[model samples]
Target: MNLTKAIAGRRSTRDYTTEAVDEKLIFRLIDAAVQAPSAMNQQPWTFTVIRDQALLERISQEAKACMLATTPVGAHSSHFQTLLSDEDFQLFYHAPVLILISGNEPNQWIVEDCALAAENLMLAAYAEGLGTCWIGFAQGYLNTPQGKHALGLPAEWTPVAPIIVGHPKSAPAPIAHKAPSIHWIG
Candidate 1:
């Protein structure tokens, strides 16, 4: 697929089928993710793939509880509150795979680097006819002691991106892209 096409076409997929993503395909996506550029060539990302259905459910419940408790602060809290409050809303959207892109070591650019890699992964999934969504709601829980313990992650690692991948139940309907705002500088 053309780079521009992939950039414009890839959408955050929320609706996924029950079918699991093949292990090989998941690795391929990660391979694409590592190709992303990093600040000072510091490839500070590590990956944790979670396929356990029961575990995902537990995380979803815990994350929703955590988000509900903290929703009183953020500007967008009310919006998320509604979704988080839904008893039926699964944080991973029933996706068969949840891949956590984490920091290998702390650095100012670790978050940015992981995010770049996340974009690469998502785009690659789109190219491969898979769907993905970066589940920000899961981040807080995933970083907590319990969450890390659940994933068997070391204390030094921090999960920056919790992306869920699967076969989308339906192709995403086309949506409008906002026009870029330009400010000229010489």
Candidate 2:
């Protein structure tokens, strides 16, 4: 697929089939991710590919519990609370793989850098006839000490993006986009 088409077609996939994403595809996406631009060319990024569905389930359960314990009463929106409180809710949406983007070292632009890499990964997946979603629900938990231990991440690294990739059960319908708003001075 062309770059413009990939950019326009990519969507945050929430539903996926049971089929597992291939290792080669995961690596290909990671390679594409690293090709993204980094601040000062400092590519301080690491990709953690998680293929075990059971582990993902455990992480989802634990993360949900942690969030429930920490969230202030009434702080979350009703829908969010319902989602988190529901034991049936799977944080990764049952996607067969999670490609976590992390910082290899501390830097002012680490988050931004990793985020750029994440976009590349997502677009690459879209181009590869795969589905991907930036699982925001997994980030906080993945960054915690327990979460880090579970993922076997190095002590110094920081998790920035928890992206799930898999085959979609069905293609998501195109969502309508609002016109861009810009303020210009020149």
TM-scores of all models?
0.95, 0.95
Worst 10 residues of 1 by lDDT: 70-79
Backbone clash pairs in model 2 (N, Cα, C under 3 Å; residues 3+ apart or in different chains), count: 0
Q: Per-residue lDDT of 1-186 in model 1, one digit per residue for the tens?
A: 998999888888999889989999999999999999999998999999999999999899999998898667678877898999999999999899999999999889999999999999999999999999999999998898988998899988988999999999988888987999999999
Clash count for each candidate, listed in order shown: 0, 0
lDDT of 2 by residue, 15-95 (tens): 998897888888899999999999999999999999888999999999898877766667566667789999899999999
lDDT, candidate 2, equals 0.92
TM-score of 1: 0.95
Model 2 stretches with alpha carbons more than 4 Å out? 72-76
The top-ranked prediction according to lDDT is 1
Given candidate 1, what's the lDDT at residue 52? 96
